[model samples]
Target chain A: MAPNGVNGSSGSHRFDPDFTRLVVENMGPNVAPRTRQLLGGLIRHIHDFAREVELTNDEWMAGVHFINSIGQCSTSIRNEAHRVSDILGLESLVDEIAHKLVVEGDVEPTSSSILGPFWSPNAPFRDLGSSIIQDPNPKGRVALMHGTITDLLTGKPIPGAVFDIWQASANGKYDFQDPENQTPNNLRGKFRADENGKYWFYCYHPTAYSLPTDGPAYKLLQLMERHPMRPAHIHIMVTHPDYRGCTTQLYPKDDPWLATDTVFAVKNDLVVDFKPKEGDPKATLDLEYNVILPPKDYKGKL
Target chain B: MAPNGVNGSSGSHRFDPDFTRLVVENMGPNVAPRTRQLLGGLIRHIHDFAREVELTNDEWMAGVHFINSIGQCSTSIRNEAHRVSDILGLESLVDEIAHKLVVEGDVEPTSSSILGPFWSPNAPFRDLGSSIIQDPNPKGRVALMHGTITDLLTGKPIPGAVFDIWQASANGKYDFQDPENQTPNNLRGKFRADENGKYWFYCYHPTAYSLPTDGPAYKLLQLMERHPMRPAHIHIMVTHPDYRGCTTQLYPKDDPWLATDTVFAVKNDLVVDFKPKEGDPKATLDLEYNVILPPKDYKGKL
Candidate 1:
């Protein structure tokens, strides 16, 4: 109408590709550089998608409704939008790309992963070699997890490096997920590295677990006919005053879900072996992982 | 990580563009054809945008927060999300593309426009030649609007074609928006076509008005340094059982906002001259427009 106005608005299902430019130009001129770049990219791509698909009016309205539902379903305790991002591998991809520069020469720093919804603030502090297994082996085999924290640049152990560790039980449930059987801090602990930067603790052998199945993300996965299982792994957040903190996850080498991790977060360097503990009274498996931290002041080449 | 898994997750801010294919692939096999096409297009475009911009974690998070705030602010009374869509000119684009095929032979049907948030059902049914100007001329000039409805294919006047019309007062405020100064349903009415398909009514001359200035859409306009005024116009909805309904707005040719209508909805055929009426006591301006309707079952070539 109005001779297609300013953008050659036409009477066809397909939009003129240059309409993207018109949309960007209409944003006026007060925008900051970064905002302009981001908004411009989004406008071009979104319009491209709509045009490529030849999205009908009903489909566009449906998409809008889906977005509104995601907002309605999201809350502080259950961030449905974040869950959607995770399921789509957006969060994982972003974290990986953001932290990719944390390397010293050819040696890459420990790859960070999604901090899944199970983590809580202020984990219970424990001794260097104390166990995080507050509950008796009520559901699965006992495991001893040990690791060393080192500087990615110096390739040397960092003593007194503070780290937080938490994982789901062998039954595939976190402490909070199974309130009746697990103790308050079961399989969750905070520890400091010893003189040699070694830290060990006892916990349950991890197992794959299903994400919440009640939200829109779950419904989307169902539509895709995809499962919602995350691979068995231990969550780690290691830090020191001289190093940049790294929040990563360690996936056992042979976990079935690793190849199809629902979150797409299994980095090769983060996979480790879980050997059998030879002669321990309270442990059955020995799980070992090592963490590498970047210098606090490190900046990648621009 | 993990040899890029199935999609080749890489370590660059510019994501491996093919990762979009991988993201779409992960959607499994149960999706309907239409859903798959839509999702695939969206995944491809969204990923392309992220990669093209080399989006940072901070920027992504800011976008997520903005989406959450939009959901929180949206309601039946004030749909901030729709407001955002309107500001971005998305609604206009979709509506234009959807109605582009309503043509017969060489004649294009009346273009459809957005059903803006102010529309209400159950308007007072008035005589075809009566006045919709229930309130006194307390703001601006009185106007006489007259039009004929005809079938695009037959080129014959359509008798008994039902139509609804509404507009803001000369003060640029709708009746509901300015309750103290305007009577209920002032400048709003439902009317039927006469034997000759002619319709006429007296109402206030329409004028420009600003959109709500307190929402995120308003704030975004502030960031873009763009004005929020909409051009002077009257809303019209014409319908008949044997023809497709058309919802459109008429923009006066000389309105200052026509060149840069905030919503980008001015079609050339929808703009008309608001001429000065001669020797008329009840009206000063004369507004005339013709409506065209397509057959209800008409379908475009696939």
Candidate 2:
């Protein structure tokens, strides 16, 4: 007898409709259930896409060549695949799906956003309220950013929540992208909330910037006639030993590209105002935001 | 006022249901009409797939990394992207869709098949009845393959139709794959039909072979619990000046893997019998087949 899940006996496979079924059936029996489901869905959808387009052989070969060129263009410093995902807005879509809030009782979870490609694991640890900007003569407006991490269920501060933050400089470049002047760990830092769950940092206000357009990603954008600009934003990942972690971005209100972020990462709840300081000349701007975390006992969607 | 195909005002673009539309709208104005249709369909389907799967951020990242790895593994000699397409049976699907016969006025077209990856443009030109096998003491059964190229409309022989043929050795390896022993262009030749539309050549009977399993394509098959073997077949491309070219393969009728060709390239019409030579002891087997071509004026779905 034929094995379970095998579409038909070996002799019965045909090209019309059975070909797809045969391809799916031939998948290894040992594949994990989730993997099987994902692969099956992917294959089915891909086949449907091909059929819907009535994809010609020349078009198929063109796609193959395009993918190969994407591969050829990738390197240690340049990730063409990641750029492709960004250009397609798939990364943001995945983020949105993966981080849906599941409310329990009265708890309200903080919104999550895209953890963009600029994140580095080596951000320096700094004291709360310390300046993250190391450059003495920075070109952008200085901002004081303050926030508190609290447990949504208990409505109490999470005293020791750690915040990993990074953002682009005034000239719209990350530290690694501008090695000529910016020192290591510039505009990136790790800090812990105080006993009152308060955290603050001084940094330059991030400026909106265009994505790298020299590679396949840019080529795609050019083909799409789409602008590659990302709105001004600061990235942060908040984590606590007892609560679920959150990776998000704080978009500045009124940014021209806010609605048209090339990566499609903006969320209304994640937008914040970067208000100009009223009295302090030294502080060019101030931002007050808060983060709410799910409790350790919470068992809901991330 | 917005441009012709722009979905909305610049500031109105959002990430909810509108994101997909924005992406489709942003496609460059100069894109060919067909390309726009294809890309638009692709973006919609990809977005739909992500939504259907509820693709997680981690899963998305994993896919990105996987694609990058496939790219990194590609070289001048190996195309991992094409291998992935083959393993997914995408290549065969494209072939099926692309080579559909567009019949006109009782014209019968030759069956088309997948163009397997081993074909090289460097096959040496040889006269009709030439021996493609250069290995003096080849260890496989010697076979005499003869074919006729005819016009589908007239059913008359089309003289001077060029045929490019290639196949693996009995050891299930191609000349390029067994460079340590096999000479360049072994079992590969370019021949033309005579005035009577007859062509013949001698070669070893091909053996079923496994695809290269060290790459991502094989890894996927292994995960799917599928074998990577392609059925024994001879690759052929016949082209006449007045006809549309035909790229196809002739599968042995009794090959064990014919029913389960790893690439799903097998079709009943493309299968031919490899009969044992009745009287000639020198020729172990013989294959007689004919090819039909559509006139250049014939234009249909394919």
* Cα distance off (Å), candidate 1, residue A255: 4.0
TM-scores of all predicted structures: 0.85, 0.88
Q: Which portions of model 2 show Cα errors greater than 4 Å?
A: A1-15, A102-108, A153-156, A296-302, B1-16, B102-108, B122-124, B299-302
lDDT values for all models: 0.76, 0.79
lDDT by residue for model 1 (B1-302), tens: 01112211232343444455666788777789888877766665555556556667877677766666666667756677777777776777677667767343778888888878677686898996789888875667787888999988888999999889988887788888889988888888988999998888887678888888877778777766778989999999999999988998999888998877777777789898888999988899998888998878887443
After superposing all C-alphas onto the true structure, candidate 2 shows an RMSD in angstroms of 6.1
> How many Å off is the CA of B192 in candidate 2?
2.8
Q: Could you tell me the lDDT of residue B259 within candidate 1?
A: 71
Q: A1-302 in candidate 1: lDDT tens per residue? A: 01112211222334444555666787767788877877766665555555556667778766666666677777776677777777777777677567757333887778788777788786899987688877765567777888888887788999999889888877788887788878788888999899999988887777789988987788878877789999888898998999989998888888888877777888788898889998899788998888888888887453
Tens digit of per-residue lDDT, candidate 2, span B1-302:
11111211122112266767876776767888888877787776676667656788788888888788787788888888888888787888888767666564665687788887788999999988879988744568888899789988789999999989998988888898898778999899999899999999897777888988788888888778788898888899999889989898888888988877888888777898888887765578999889988887777543
